[model samples]
Target chain A: MIVGERKPLDEILEMVKDAKKILIVGCKGCVTVCNAGGTKEVGILAATLRLARLKEDNPIEIDEMTLERQCDPEYIEILEERAANYDIILSMACSIGPQYISEKFPEAIVYPALNTCFMGGAQEHGVWAEFCQACGDCKIHLFGGYCPIARCSKSLLNGPCGGSADGKCEVDKEIDCVWHLIVNKLMKQGKLDQLTQVKPLKNWTTSRDGGPRKIVREDLKI
Target chain B: MKSGSNLEKLLNAGEFVITGECGPPRSADASVVREKAKYLKGYVDSVNVTDNQTSVVRMSSLAGSLILQEEGVEANMQMVCRDRNRIAIQSDVLGATALGIRNMLCLSGDHQKFGDHPEAKNVFDLDSIQLIQTVKMMRDEGKLISGQEMAEGTEPRLFIGAAVNPFADPFEYRVYRLAKKIAAGVDFVQTQCIYNMDKFKEYMKQAHDMGLTEKVHVLAGITPMKSLGMARYMQKSVPGMDVPDEIINRLKGVEKGGQSKEGINILLDQIQILKEIPGVAGVHLMAIEWEERVPEIVEAAGLLPRPTV
Candidate 1:
């Protein structure tokens, strides 16, 4: 799940103020689960835009469409014919969807309706919390399904630092110390001895520190 | 105070009221909508152009209301608080009043998960109650939510309306919520589809007891069930909808040829019962896809020529 929130209406209105023919495009992907960039969201944006334009007496034409997966070319190709009808495409899909639409329809102007936040899940109804960084590395297995890269302010790979007090992070008292959680899990599993071993320095270059990483799976390719 | 508008006159006279719902165009074409307006010109006292109804995007509700006003029909602008914040909501209300759309209905709106764009972001800046209060504040105080006075001292006057459901789960809360809205300065109320007259009568009695019968105008929302599947979906999927077991059984009793007729008849029967209720001000007919059948339903219920206040 991707955790995100909608941009303010005034900001969105400013973005597409001059667009006479606006197409509010929604995606049925990560954004849908997070209550953004879905068919319902597109309708809301369309209605709000309509009201805004009417208020200014600048009555603009609005058309709404939702795609299954906006990031996929196959899903986006379906909109090629309809793309020419609008002056601007307001994508309610995730950040990737707008980029894909721009890539596919180079001539049409594309705008993002939602602020792309982070990869996470719903903490509860109407509340979403970020839990992953997609750091191009898998260390959760060693730490019992918790990613310190996302949960910790320091992104420490080893045991709790002296800064951690009362199982809370030193940076933000509200946040729990990830290393503390890791130690508690290890102690419960009777593997506290694992903490005694000095861990090697992590290779920071393999993460986002290295610009634009790609994976070529020869076995999956046709 | 005698207003020049016929709608104002009707409201003052206390006659049986007439209200109709207009579905906004899905595209930019206004000709089709213009044609529909012609049918409702003299037939209905007021026409409600929905705002992104069911969370499906369409032509602007404000634009549609303006168009209806142009077509010589009184427009009731439906304003949903699903997408706009307090600033946009206040601005739109003032704009609608300036454009001659005096009738307004405030709604919390259906969640985006149900609409075509399920992934679109939702901005519930205010719920229906807060929206009503916002409008009242604007009308009474002539100021925005920030408590800033208008430069021109213009007051936005609206026949503010809100929605209620008699058949919603936890039935007492539904009635309590309506009371809260009325207290929040809602002048009128339009209920969800009335499928069960007995339940409606019970609800009406409670409303009367609450003294809402005199202070607020109550309109019964009547939507003619098109098919069995639609009825089933309304019962199962639509929140705050209650289709009684007897009505469902009656709908089932009809053969394939008579299903549509049976459904329409059931709606008519409900309206007939609703009209007899003492406190009901009018009927807000929502013919969804079958807008053409509204005149027939209104006529069948003996509500043609719209009673004046």
Candidate 2:
């Protein structure tokens, strides 16, 4: 799931400094699951911004709305008629929300209140760890279901670079080397032979390096 | 044959090559590099120039290598993926080679947190292994990684080098990793700083068992720990490096100022043992911030009057 965090109050204040009326739009998709742009977070953020503005004698007229999902155009259409009623729309969702809202409602001034981080899931209650890089070429099954692209600091595909030590990545001791994890799993599963063969240079066409990717489903196409 | 680099010539002739390292200064001033090069001059075959090592802003390795070239000291320019994409990397490769740099060490540099700029964004478009493949393609195939053909007579014939750490984890897989690099067209390898002789010997035995020792030159890395404090720091803090407790104890046994001397003795002993190891082709001395002691250390290790050819 995509994870993001609320941008600082100062930056958000700067973006909506001239606005007297603001609409805070949250997403009930990945941002909601990550607790970043959920409805509760939207209420909390709206209150904080209002209190901050009221204390400065510049009261902000704010209203809260949580879209079922912002990335989809149909959900974003719910706000099309009301988007022009405010000076600005504060998107408390992942980067995709503001973009879709802005693209759909070109007349609305959409500001992303959250900084989109990565596609990851929660490791624990308050901790989220990145697990996928969306390389589009999913070969995790080959490495015992571990995604080196997201976990390994170097993102080495063939094997661990010379930076793995004590099962920790050289980038930081707290971080486990993804190759170490993969090799351990492979050895435990008696699939250690998979490592003997060096994987070829990754064909990056499937990656964002080539450009933004697209998928066409001919089977479902009309 | 590889761009007239003396280090390559030494290794090719079955000689134990001795290369040193010089980290570029944070400032643009070239005097620090020149001053450091003075100690290593004629005491080592080639000096490895670090590019933004540990992610601290420094005078680039290319410019520092040029400065060393002016001092009659050949440089092995180190390139890392933490800062540049393929465009900058390929462009810098051509630029450095045009400026007369013959050797390049490709690496996935240390992450930014180790340096002053921890919040900076990193561009690891290609790790060290891929970087080696890119350089090999450019030099041998005369094409960019994009596979675009270089203009006639535009290829840079470079002696490619990469770093390996026998001390890193999943020790059993380290040898096979070296084989992958040889297939990637790396000419020589300089390893991480070594203090664990037993483990490194085991690592080398596996490389020999895999028959990789004969295909690529392996230069064991040796850094003289300046004090017990330094040794302890490496054992606890430095990643991909291990300093054995016995060595730390040995340094502790020495008196205050004598720890550095004991450290030198320990490094000399490691070098001697590495020379006798079957697969070891050379030793790369990374004196770290202590570059001035290189001349004496080289002289003591019987590697003085570094080979001229």
The lDDT values for all models are 0.77, 0.89
| Best model per TM-score | 2
Interface RMSD of each: 24.0, 2.0
Per-residue C-alpha lDDT of model 2 across residues A1-222, encoded as one tens digit per residue: 999999999999999999999999999999899999999999999999999999999999999999999988889889968999999999988998999999988889999999999989898998898899988889988888999888987677766877667898777778888899998888888887687665656777789888998889999877
- By DockQ, who's the top model here? 2
| Model 1 misplacement above 4 A | A1-222, B1-8, B151-153
Q: Estimate the Cα RMSD of every predicted model relative to the unseen true structure.
A: 21.3, 2.9
Candidate 1 residues A26-76, lDDT tens each? 998988888987888889889989999999999989998899988789999
What is residue B12's positional error in candidate 1, in angstroms?
3.5
lDDT of 2: 0.89
Candidate with the greatest lDDT versus the true structure = 2
